[model samples]
Structure formats: structure tokens, C-alpha cells
Target: MAPHTHIKSVHTLSPIDPWWKRNLVTYHPTPKKSRHIKVPWWSRKCAAALQAKRHAFAAWRKNPTPPLRQRFHYLEAQCKRVILDEKRLAWASFCASLSFSISVSQAWSFFRKMVHPQPPLTFQ
Candidate 1:
């Protein structure tokens, strides 16, 4: 095996290059007039009133209604109980269905054996 030698070269960009001219020096047009326009007073007042109404509604919602909360909690608990009951019922139904299928298969095998009896052979 022989030893390998590697060489590297460095490249420099020129000032007169098209890339330098395009990137380093670019022209942008000045705005002829100001872009910002003043909002009308009526619109501002309406926006303020809408904001106030939203704040009032938010405050109203933040103060919890005790009766409503109690009712909601009660209903939620009932729903949980119902869901548990439904799961138990579903498991029972599944067990019943599995037992019924097993019984049906056994009954079918017995009926097939009874209907088709094998003949006996006698040798001389």
C-alpha cells in the first residue's frame, strides 16, 4: 500500500462580479407620501364600546353560578355512573354471546355424529 497526498485551493470573489453588484448595491424607491392614515372617531368609539361589552361579558362568565355548577357536577357524575354501567352490561352481553356460541357448536357436532353413523365391516 502507498501513502496518498491531498491538495486544497482557495477561491476569492472579485469586486467587479455581477453577483457583487446585484447584492451589495440595490436601489429602493422612496415613498411619495406617508402610508399611515388616521382612523375615524365613530369607528374608534364603536370599537371601544365593543371591547367594553366583551370585558363585561367575560367578568359575568368568570363569576360562577353556584346552582348551575352544582347541576353540572350532578349530571357529570350521573354520566360517569351510566358509562360504567354500560361497560358492565356490554361485558355481560359478550360473555353470554360467547357461551351461546360454544353451546351451539357442541350441539351441532353432536347432531352431525347422530345423523351420520359409521358402518361395521366383518372379515371371513
Candidate 2:
């Protein structure tokens, strides 16, 4: 019958379904991480070569013909060569960018990164 008693009854906390639990249950979402990690030396050319090699390998796997097998091997080799070239070019450019113009600290940072690359981020 009292006003304070009425307010307390209206705002009473229940144990069956807490407000925080309701919110957490309603907020199911996808992971906010990237699917593909970018490699320093990865390029469109390398992607194209790898795609071609995958296709060749699939084709060879379906029908085990000698020609298809050879084609797959050739594409695999081409992909490796392209990837190596890209890595070499990337390293050369990075080294070229570091010169007498850069400060000692920057040069040392560059050298450290080149010597010990950071580990890629992983999502479980």
C-alpha cells in the first residue's frame, strides 16, 4: 500500500534471467578478425601464379595423365619462382630504402625487423 514498497517491488532483481545475461545471449556475432593475413612479399602476380598452379594440380588429380602431370609440375615450379622473385624484390626495396639519410635508430629498427620477423596473428 505504501509508495516506497510499490517502487521496491517493481524494481526487484530476479535470478531467473539477469539483464546482463539477456544482453550477452542476444549479441551473437561473427569474429572480427581478418581471414587472410597479408605477407610483405605477397603480390597479385604471385596470387595469379598460385591460382594457376592450383588449377593445374586439380586437373591433374582428376585425370592422372602424363601431360597433365607435367603441366602441373611446370606450373608449380613457375609459382615457386614467382614467389621467390617477389620476396627478393621486396627485400631489395626494403634494404634500398634504408640508407645514410635515415637516422641510426630507424636503421637499427629496420635491421631488427629484417633479421627477426614478427609472428603472424592467429585466430582459434
Candidate 3:
């Protein structure tokens, strides 16, 4: 013979609480702006030169010839020189725009920006 079982009554939940009031739901604030950004300083010409240098490097790797190797080295040096020259020119222009009455903090900030240009920033 099968055993008999008794049914138990269950209590219903009172009501559903708001999502914001739930314990598992967390509130995250939206990001309006970034605290810091990294800006690229590579100009179109500089970028093209660098790409050409990379291509030269790959070609030299396949052929391993004296001419190809020399060309690669030449392009590498030229690209580096161009990048540095652009940075120097930019810094010179920035310094030229500054007046003689600016605070030291401002000068330092400007110098930092010149060293590392950040995006979302407008240079004066």
C-alpha cells in the first residue's frame, strides 16, 4: 500500500518592491567625461614615413641584401628625426603663444601638455 502525504499551505509575498530599492540592484553613475586622455602626435607625413620604414624592414627581412638593409636603417632614422622635429616645432609654437605674466603652475601644465597631448583638450 502507498503511504499518504499531507499538503502544506504556503504564504504569498506581500508585493514587488521597486527595482532601485532592491538589494541586489546597484546604482552606477554614468560617466560624463574622462579624467585623462591620450592624444596622438603623429602627423600624416610622419605616419607615412614610419609605414615606409616598416615596409623597408619587411623587405630587408625577406631578401637580407645590403641595399635593402641600408635603406631600412635610413628610413628608420629619417622617421625618428621627423617625429622629434614635429614635437619640437609644436613646443616652440606653444611657448611663443604664452605671455610673460602667466603663473608657474600654468607654465608647468602647458609644458606637460606639450610633452603629452591629450584628446578632448583644446590647445590655446
Candidate 4:
């Protein structure tokens, strides 16, 4: 058996080829054009309402109860419940916003496809 020799060479080029060509890979990222779609007024209103409710509950919890700390504990529990409900409402509003964005994107894509379509080609 003979000893194997390793060769290292580097080439410098004027203009570099695109990443896809150099790496021999193609990547198509999801289009972000949907961000242009405006969110619904109702969704914004609901989110605002939930935020306000959460803030109000927090304010209510700030006041100290009398010598009976048990009452304060109960109020704290109530505050926690209110906060949880607000979080739920906020989550629902967020989901609504996401759905609205998805629908808008679908509609836009359909419209684009209708306007300009790829032509079919035949090979000899």
C-alpha cells in the first residue's frame, strides 16, 4: 500500500455566484406580503378591552385589606381569575387576527394566480 497525498487548492473569482448556485441548493421562503393586510377593528377592540380589564384587576389588587389578611387573600384570588380571563380573551383575539391574515393571504394568492399564470411547455 502507498501513502495517500492530500491536495488543497483555493480559487479566487471576480464575481461570486448566487448562494443557491454555489451550494447547489434551492430554498423558497414563505412570502411575507400578507403583512400588508389590515387587521379588523373588532379584533383590535377586543384586545384593548382585555388589556384594560387586566390593568383594572391589577389596580384593585393594590389596595391593602384590614387586619383580616384572609380577605386580602380572597381578593388576590379574584384578581388572579380576572387576569386569567383577560389572558384567554387576548389569546382568542390573537387567533382571530391570525385567521384574518391567513384568509387575506389566500385571497391575494388566488387573485395573483388568476391574473398571471405559468405557461405550459412541451419537450421534443
Give stretches of model 4 more than 4 Å off. Answer: 1-67, 100-124
lDDT of 1 by residue, 1-124 (tens): 2322331211233444555435434542333764333211113333344444445445546776776556555554554454345445545554565654477775555445333322111110
TM-score of each: 0.30, 0.59, 0.52, 0.28
- Model 4, 3-121: lDDT tens digits are 22331211232234344334332353334653232322224334444455545556556754453355545655664465456446645664565654477776565445333322112
**TM-score for predicted model 2 compared with the true structure:** 0.59
- With a 3 Å backbone cut-off (N, CA, C), the pairs that clash in candidate 3 are none
Instruction: Supply candidate 4's per-residue lDDT for 115.
Output: 36
lDDT of 3 at 59: 100
Per-model root-mean-square deviation over C-alphas: 32.3, 9.9, 13.7, 18.3
lDDT of every model, 2 decimals: 0.42, 0.68, 0.65, 0.43
Clashing pairs in model 4?
A: none
Best by TM-score: 2
Q: What ranges in model 1 sit over 4 Å off?
A: 1-63, 99-124
Tens digit per residue, CA lDDT, model 3, 18-75: 3323422245333476565433344676667778888999999999999999999999
Ranking by TM-score: 2, 3, 1, 4
